[model samples]
Each structure stands twice: as structure tokens, then as C-alpha cells.
Target: MKRMRGLLVLTILCFLISSVTSLQAWEILQQSGFSQALGDIFFIDEQKGWATGYQGVIIHTQDGGKTWSQQKVELPCDSELYNIYFADDKHGWVTGSYVMGDGFILNTSNGGETWKIFKTKDMEMPYSISFIDNKKGWVCGFGNGTILHTEDGGKTWDVLYKPEKNYLWRQIFFENAQKGWVIGCESPQKGKFFDTIMATKDGGKTWQVKYYKPVADEDWWYPWSSIWFVNEQEGWATICKKEATLLYTKDGGETWTKHQFNLGSWLYSVKFINQKEGFISGNLADSGKGALFHTKDGGISWELTAEFSKSLRKIHFLNSQEGWVTRSNGYFYHTINGGKDWECQLEPKTHLHDICFVDRNNGWAFGKYERGGGLILHSEDGGRNWDKQRLELPSGDWQMGIHFMDSQHGWTGVSILGPNSTGAFLQTKDGSKNWSITEIEYLPQDIHFSDAQNGLMIAEIEGGPLVMSFVQTNDGGESWQVRNKVARDKELGGRRIPSRIQCLNAQQWWVMSSWCLSYTSNNGKNWTQKKVPDTSGFYFLDDQIGWFGSNRLYHTKNGCQDYKEQELPMPIEWISDIYFKDSQEGWCLGNRYYVGDSLERCIIFHTTNGGETWEVDLKSPQHLHRFGYASGRLWAVGDNSVVYGIATQAVSALGKQYITLGKVKTVLFQNYPNPFNPETWIPYQIAQDSDVTITIHNIKGETIRTLQPGRQRAGAYILKKQAVYWDGKDDKGEEVASGVYFYTLRTSDFSTSRKMVIFK
Candidate 1:
């Protein structure tokens, strides 16, 4: 009888695992949204252009920058694409680097419908690409001032020059097949560096230094950023120094003159439509505001034609009347009338830090601009369209905490600059259309309001020992009173500042930090400290039911009298936020840090058994900060303007299948020992007898193998012995290359897919 009970328990555990892996994946509601910082842009004409930037993103436009579409590159999606060049309408090239210190070049011959990738092992980080024609081009970057030449349309490349160690080539331009120029900077010793412009006359067989800037103090050095030539004799270059400097050459490459602008700007790119009309793009040093300067008298006198919230990276012009400028914070502008008017091509000029939704159709996102100011964005139709809210704020002010009781009652904490920069709270009673500022003596880190007349704030008081105080307001934030203060533990020798706060009502409050957890039941008249396990996040459904998350999850049901530890399937480094709709359903955002790699990939974990077990619902490259639930959907917002939403009903439906409602249906589990070297196992389960098959495909969606496992009986095939196996080979018995691959399971009426990685 004991053995029979053991078998039943094992069967139930297998069913739980199977059902947990079958949950619906989260979908991105809004991303990119022109929020990727663009590095370079190129236009073959006024109608067709391409821009490359962060995250290996390549966007193309066919309607004169009015609309854009993403293009796939045959490399890691996280690689950094820097420079793009098109020799004509049909052929083009892009250069970028991976975070793991490897440079790559992408070429397209059919107008970017597809791309072919070539790895440059010798060039650690290629920054610039210049092609005089389709067949001959040169690339320069930071492999000890490396210059590479490609004579056969980038199929192969030959090293042309590697001047010295600690040299970084920034930009390259070629006027013809034999005459080319490379601008870069080099550090001869430890403390100082200088800039140089080198000219190659024999298609990169040899080079001569045409101009060299002497090394200045270690505190200051002018580095060349970009160079452009309208004709053989008229050319221009930009130097990114404390003050913007322009280098001009009228007599070919023999003689050059310098022009300086005392606007406290750092110029990046220079372009000239004719000898007399030119433009320079950069940003102000103090304010980080993107600025575009136009020169109408051959680089003699300049006027500020445009400015943006972020710095400008590159500027391109087909003519004086038609040009494009790319900002450093994922924005681009187009002008059709010689810089007199410009139209921005992207939306959301801020990096969202937190988001809240009172209902399914109404929400608000809080963030700060790249140039240092707070921003409030409101959406009326479930974040499909957002409009910026106008608020009169001090310069250099940013929001740190926000809470909204409903659509009409909201408050935000603003951190400003000046003497006594203690920050202030902006309270709104009529849906943020108007706000009243209430100055406070402490900086608010997090705030929660139970009603319009009662709220609690976790604030930081500046003085000594890093004090964190809980303040309360009973009259709608018109005034605040300190309730309790927690100071740093001098004996522990670690800063203990409150990171998150929750207010259940006027009498119940909870506050947590990395090293401590505390709660107050009667408006902070008394407090009790609960033992925590290096807490990273905390969530409470009520005073009795609460959870604390770190590498592991801890749950309490009796107001922290005792805690139960829940085992997660995989190891997590940290949990950023937690949200629970009820006692049985919850979600937590975590990050998994790999050994020897600096990148921390974010993951969303879902639980339906009241933290008894958890399953990964989503994986994202961007960091997610908070989670919200409204109208049967779960929402998350984080870095890079990412907003993701998933239907909670779908999750609940999947949860009910194996836990309560019925038997487990077809379910596909993620492969074990993911990022395998020689082999991996694919686990799955089936409810009834059916024909089962598994197909493997590469990242490009080309099928590599189709495994016919024949008919399988109803049961959980989740163990290693029962799972389907792949030997890391294609159907033709050839070992597959190391990269990302997808495996799909099809059984009768059900089909699903999951991703895996292979590293050799």
C-alpha cells in the first residue's frame, strides 16, 4: 500500500510539470516604437533608406521615412549594428559587433530582402563601412586601428592596415577606387591620445598620414567622428571635442582649415550637399540636447536649424532640401525644405520606468527624457496610442514614485535640482489634467495610496547613515508626517534602504529592503521585523498572505509568523518585482545571470499552485521593472519602452487542465540541458493515443529534421527516459552549427514550439 501511494504521488508530480510548461506565452503589446537608439542612417534616394542601431536592428523605409519595417540579419539579435552604406538601390552593406568582442558585416544584393553575414575575426569592433562601388570597399574600427579592404563585394576581406595598439578608427570615406581617408584616434601611452587622418592612394596597399593632431592633456583630446566628401576637392570632417570643431579642405587632401563653434557641443557627423551648403549634427555638452547646425557660406557661418531631446549620431543628405538625421535615443527626423521644417519619425521620447493601469482601457506610464526631465504619457485605448501630458516642472526634474488610486486621483513624486532638492509630490484630483505640488523634506522612493485622503510614502532622508523613513498623509497629500524611520545597520556594515512599500489600508503597511523586511499594523505606532532571505521583491494579497522572492520564493499565510520555501525549477539570480492576483495565481519577474557572461536575461515566472510550483511564462532581453493586471490581462513594463501583455484567462485555462479541470493534453516542454553541446532531450506529454512527431528548425525557419516517434499512449512522457532525443544533427547526419534553434511538436490536433540553444 505504501508503494502504491508513492506511485500515485509520482504520477501527480509529472502531470503538474506537464501542465506548467504548456502555458500560453506572453505577447509584446508595444516595443521598439522608434525607441531603439539608432547609430547610422543611409538613403539611396528620398524614398528608400535603411537605419541600423542597438540590438542588431535594421529598419528600412520605402515611403520617404514615413513608415519602416524590420529586416532580419543572420547574426545574434543582440548584436550592435553601427554603420550602414548602400552602393546603389539594390546592393548594400552594414557593419557592427557582438558584445562578445567579434565584428561582423552584413551584405544584401537584392535590396535588403535578405542578408548574408560574414564574421571578421581580426576586427574586434568594426565601426565604419565605406564602399566606393559594389565591388570595392573599406572598413575601419577598433582592432588596433584596423582597416580592411574588400574587392569582391564583401565575400572576402584582406587586412590593409593595423597601425598600433590602443588605436580606434571611427569613420572612413572613399572618394574613388584609390583615394580614401580614415579618421581615428590613438593612445601612444597610458595617459594621452591624439587624432589622425590617414590617406590611402593605392586601394589600401599603403597609407600616409595627411593630418595629425598632437596629444594634449589627458583631461582633453579632440577625437574625429565623421568625414564626408562632396567632390574630390571639397570635403568636411567633424571633431567631437568640448567645443565643436569642423575641418574643411578645399584643395583636395593637401591643405585643411579648422572652424570652431563655441556652443559647448560635441559634433559627430558632417555632410555637405554642395561646396557652399553643409550640415553638422551633434549634441550640447551640458544639456545633452541634440543639435543640428546648417552652414550656408561654405562652413563659415552656421545657424542652429534643429534640436532634440537626445544627442544626434548621424546625418545624411541627398540634397539640401532632402535630408535625414538620426538621434542617439531612437529618433530620426526628415526635412523637405532645407531645414526650415522637420518631421520626427518615431514616438515616445522617454525611457519608461514604471507603468500603471486603473482599467483595461486607461493607463499611464511614467519615465524621464534622455535630456533630464520627467515625462507622463497617458493612453485611453489600452496602450495602443499614447499622448504626452503637459506638466509644468522645474528643469532637470524626474519622477521616482507614482501611485494612482483611480483614473481621477493620482500622485507622483518629483526629484528636482536646486538648493534643498528634497523633491516634491504632485497630486492630481481630476485625472492628472491639473496638479498641485507639495514640497517635502525627504525624497520619495515608492508611494501607495489607499484612497484620495490617505497614503503612505517610503522616503529617503539625507543626512547620515542612510535613513529610510515612512511618512503618511491623511489629507490628500497636502501635508505629510513622519511615522517611522529605519537607519543603516552599522554593525552589519551594509546600507539598508527601503526599496518597496505596500499599503493595504490606513492601518496595515509593509516595507522591504534587500536586507530587511518590516511591517506595521496600526499606522506605524508599532513595527515587527520579519526574517528574510536576502529579499529582492515582496508582494502581499493581504496581511496574512504574502510572499518574498530572492533566488528562491518564500510564502507566509499567518502574517509572517512562519514561512514556507517554494522550490523553483531553475536558479534565478534576483527577482525584481512580484504581483499576485489572489492566493493561487501570481507572477514574478526575475533575472538569470550566466557565469562568465555579463548579460542578465530577464524572465517572467508564473505560479498557479500558490507558489508550490512555478513555470517560465516569458523570456526577454530587456529588464522588466513592474507588473500590473487589469481586465483579464497581465501587463509588464520595463527598459527600452517595452510593454508586454498576456491574457490571464488563457493562463488560467491552461492551469486548470492538469490541476483541476481535466487530464493533461498535448504539452511541449523546453529541452533539458539547454545550450547543449552534443545532444539534448525534448520532454512532452500526451493525453490520449495519437501520432506524434517532432520537427527541428534553425533560426531562419528552415527545417533541419523531422523525427517520427510513431504513436504514443496517454501519459506524461516528461522524464529523460521517456522524452524524445535529438543528437544535435540534421537528418543527413551532419552536425549543426552552434546557434539558436526551434523545435515543434505536433500531435493530432495540438501543436506547439519552443526554443533551444547549442554552443560548441
Candidate 2:
């Protein structure tokens, strides 16, 4: 009897460990590589610095700008941080505007380990910040020339100066407590504006105009993008216009001299290490390349030292040999040898517009870099990692559509925009190792392949009566033939243009334009038009069953002979893409719009019983453009270089349980007794039997521990005895330091991650 009892206990323990190890959830294959544009950068020394940008992002670097780690700031969504100032290592402040137009300041006392927010209700969007010490600072920006001052370390702020009614201060600089200068633009009337500079003598108590320049406002220039002072006697300001302009002051802003360079660039930030050396950062207006210039003779003559794909925003230099520059797309560079050479310290920034997969293990994502030029990313092993493929194209070109018939045959459309602008078809055999370009007469909007040799494309014609044309390739894209034309619709005020195209076989094709849906039964020779509410999304499961999406869902069962409106579980403003695996399972990509917000919230809706009903499957903060299904999984690609995958089989198996179990959804609950010392418990629930694992990561995204609890049956593990426990030790049984850490619960089909704090 004793041996039997011991055997039973061992059996239970083995089952417990194995049961906790299995589950499934949607997994992020590629992270959103820095979605927001960086606005400002500041370094207290050569070894420590901070940078701020949109979406309340604050990243800190300890070894200059070689590598950086994110610091969490609890702000509302869409908050824009514009400027950062550090009085020392432990005291710093960041200024920006909230989503509702109120300005805010983030103050940190423990070197950005924590932050306190102070909202300035009276200010309407602060842009620049200047500090002389830890307690005294000034912020200036949009509020009818309003300037704010803080003497008690951002706990309270008082309005210091308000200039004319239409003056928009851009930057503020202070040489000391009693003397300072502010530069901005002023518009006494609509459509006419000029640059203005003001000087203060009594710590912003009294001000006088030092210089003003009136222009015709032909191209609308923001006169002063940035301003810096080496001393009270010498200063410089950069201008944003068609040509790069630098303004130099020798007598404390009393008079200024203008120097112009024909670089066709917009200068943003200027910094000087001494009286005779300076650096300026900006972007070329034509190609969007980040530009850096160095001058040893102050502002007289400059040499182009470096150029990159993204636009450069801010520059911070601790001395002549060490400095950092930030890009508009959340990338910063470090230079140890002045401006001669620099190294990037972040992932490359690109926007993935369309994705295609020949099988489960082979795929390609097509888009453009944030700076310019075409980008193609290939992934093997189901998108766990991605590598870039080289396609020789101009900086002004971008890819639009991609289609693959197999692992070795593919074609992509390229839109060329420059002198003699047109489009071309890029065809590749042997798995994208080499591509040959075929020039076409119009821009290719969308392309679809029915087989290896038969393909259909919708092309847009410029400066012609024919708005769009249908092109066909019969011999594997070696040559193309124009088969039909879509004239501009006079009923819609000549605005109808083809946006998407679908091919079912060699004989049937469909096209969705802005105003109508057109289909042809005999390979694009003749077309029949059908009117729908809108043409945001369109999909055809076969020749018989089809769906169209606008603000509402419309379905057809017999090849568009008639339509019926379907109901959605939630409200969506617009549907961007639609896909159906069969007559019963489908998914739609859409957005929900709020009344006052400028951004659209993206959501994915899934249906198990066709168009009769749908349920919310996923929601994303980043914009998701397109998706595809392959190898029993759904893959999506979108803005910020993000790629996501989810197993469809997991959702199908949980369908019946969702009805019986009151719609139980997979959830990863917050850890108990957060900020605890040396111990914590993580609780979660799975909708189906799945492989489960929990990973702990530090603020720098380095994994510290991974707990595998085996395969778990469908149920809640929310009780303390049932939850996964951690002993606050790393993989090597060493104690972790006190800081912020992230814990992610991943299943075979679903995944959710959240942050936890360790205080001891």
C-alpha cells in the first residue's frame, strides 16, 4: 500500500509539469521596429543620454549612444514628446503635448528609473526646453507665443512671457539665469509669416525684439528650427526651407548674418562645441536622405560628412570627438571620431505593405524604408527571422504588389517616381536570387496569379482618358498584353479608379475600383459592373461565394447575382482587407474610428459560421495593412516593420468551448503583489489544450528566465496554488537587480506579455 501511494504521487507530479507546458496563441514574429519619429536628444555626459519621441517613448543609453534601453512612461496614447533636458545624471525633464492639446512635463529624479508627470493646463503644446540647473528651466512653443518657466523642478509652472497674437516660438536658449533668447515665426495675417528673434535681460521679465526678417512666404518656411548658444556673445540658428540657411550672431543676437547653401535640404538642429567648430543635421528635400555637415570655420563653409536614408532630427555633442545624432524613424547614431564616421544603434526602419508566402517556411514582405528606396524582406522557418534581399532601384521608387506561384517563381510591381516617371514589373526565377525588370506604360496597382503562367494585373494610366487597364501575362511574365480598359466614371465625377484585382482561373477575373465592382467571365475581355455601398475590401472564395466590405458587410452566394447584408459583433468604420479559407471560416481587417482622435484603431474579426456572425479575434495599436494564410497559420504585416502569426487550428478547436464556456478567451493576468521582493506568481488562462511557457526579460529585452510547465488542458490557472511561481532568480540561479521586467505567457496559439516591477 505504501509503494502504490508513492507511485500515484509521482504520476501526479509528472502530469502537472507536462500539463503546464502546452498551449497556443498569436505570436509576434517581428517587432514594430521603432514606429515613432524621434524629436529630441540630450546627453549629460559621454556615457549617459536620453532621447524622446512620439508615443511617449523614452530610451536611455549608458555607453553614449552605442546601445539604448527603453524607459517606461505612463502617459495617454498618442502623446508626443518633443524636447529633453538633463541637469545632471539623476535629474531630468521632458516636455511635449498630450493628445488633447495640453502640454506636460515628465520629471525623473532617479536617472529615469521612475518618472512623475505634471500637466500644464494653460499651455497649448510646448516644443523646446532649456535648463540651467536641476530646478530652474524654461519651455517655449505654440500658445500664441507663450513661454513657461519652472523654478521648483517642474512641480509648478508659471507663464513667463507672451508675445504677439500669432507668434509661434520654436526654440529657446539661455546662456545664464538672467540672459536668454527665443526664436520663432510670426504671422500678423493669414498666409504671410516671417522669422523673429527676441532677447530677455531680466530673466524673462522684460524682452525686446533683436531681429526680424520678412519674406514673401512662397514655400512657407519655418524660419528657426533650432537655436544654440556657445556663449552670450556668439550663437547660431537653423532654418527649414528649400535651401539650407544658417544665421550667425556675434553680438548677443543684436545683429545677424545669413549664410546660404545650395544643398536642397531642410536644416533642423545645429550644435557647436566651440566658437570655431559646429555640426548641422537635416534631410535632403528631394530624396529624404539624412544629411550631416561639419564646419571647422564656424558657419562660413561646411562639408558633407555623412548621409543616411532617414532624416536626421536632433544632434547632441559632449565634445568635438564624441556625439550622437537621432533619425526621424527612432534610430540614433554614435560617432567617436567627430563627424567623420558613425554607427547606427538600432534596427532598420521600414514599412511592410504586402506579404506573400509560397509555403509555411518560405515568405517575402515587400515595402519601403522610412527614408526611401524599395525594401524586400525574406523569411524562412515560418518568419522567425527575416533577411533583406537586394533589388537595385532608385531612391524614389517603391514596391506596390507581390505574387508568388511557387518557391522559385515570383513577380513584384515597382512604382518609379522622378524625371520621366513610370512603372515596371520585376520578375524573378530561382527564388529571388536575380530579378529582371520589364518596363511598362502605367503604374501597376494590383497583381494576381491564377497559375504559373496566367496572371492578371490592374494598371493605372496617367494623363489619359482611360483611367485603368487590365494587363495579362501568359508565358510566366516574360511579356504582358493589355486586354481591357476602364474609363473614368462620369457618374462619380471622374474619380473611379481600380484599387484591387483578383483572379479565380484563366477565364474568370474580378476588379474592385473606388466606385464599383467589375467582373469578367471570359478573361477580362468584357466586364459587368455591380454597385455596392463602398469598395474598401473584396474577396471571392470561389466562383460562387464572395464578400464585400465597407462600413457594413455584404455577401453573395451565387456569383454576385444578389447580395445580403451580414451582421458584425462590433462596430468597425472601414474594412481594409478580407480573406476566407472556406465557406465557414473567414477573417476581415478593419479599423474603428473615434470622434476626436486622428488615428484609426485596427481590429481583426473572425467568423466560424460564415457571414451570419463574427467575433473580434485580435486588436493592434500599429496599423496592419494586409494578411495571408498558409500552412494552417495566418500571417499579417503592417507599419513599423511588424509581422504576426497565429495558428488557425487552435481557434477552430476552441470554437465549441467558446460557446459552452461563456466565450472564454485566453488571458495572461498581472502578477500578484507587484513590486515584491524575491518572489512572485504568474496566473493565466488558456482556451484550449496547448503548450505553455513563460519568459522573463529585463528592461533591455534580454531574457533572464524561461519556465516550461508542459502541456496544459483548457482551464483557468488563476488560483495561487495553480499558478506558475518564480523565485526572482535568473536562468543560472542568480538574483536579479531591482528594476522593471517583462513577463510573457506564450501558448501554441496565443501570447500576451505584460510588465512587472521588482522593488528590492
CA lDDT of each prediction against the hidden true structure: 0.73, 0.74
Instruction: Estimate the TM-score of every prediction.
Output: 0.74, 0.73
lDDT of 2 by residue, 330-398 (tens): 677888898788887665567777888888879887877765656677776677767666454566644
> Measured by TM-score, how close is model 1 to the native structure?
0.74
Clashing pairs in model 1? none
Which residue window of length 10 is worst by lDDT in model 1?
8-17
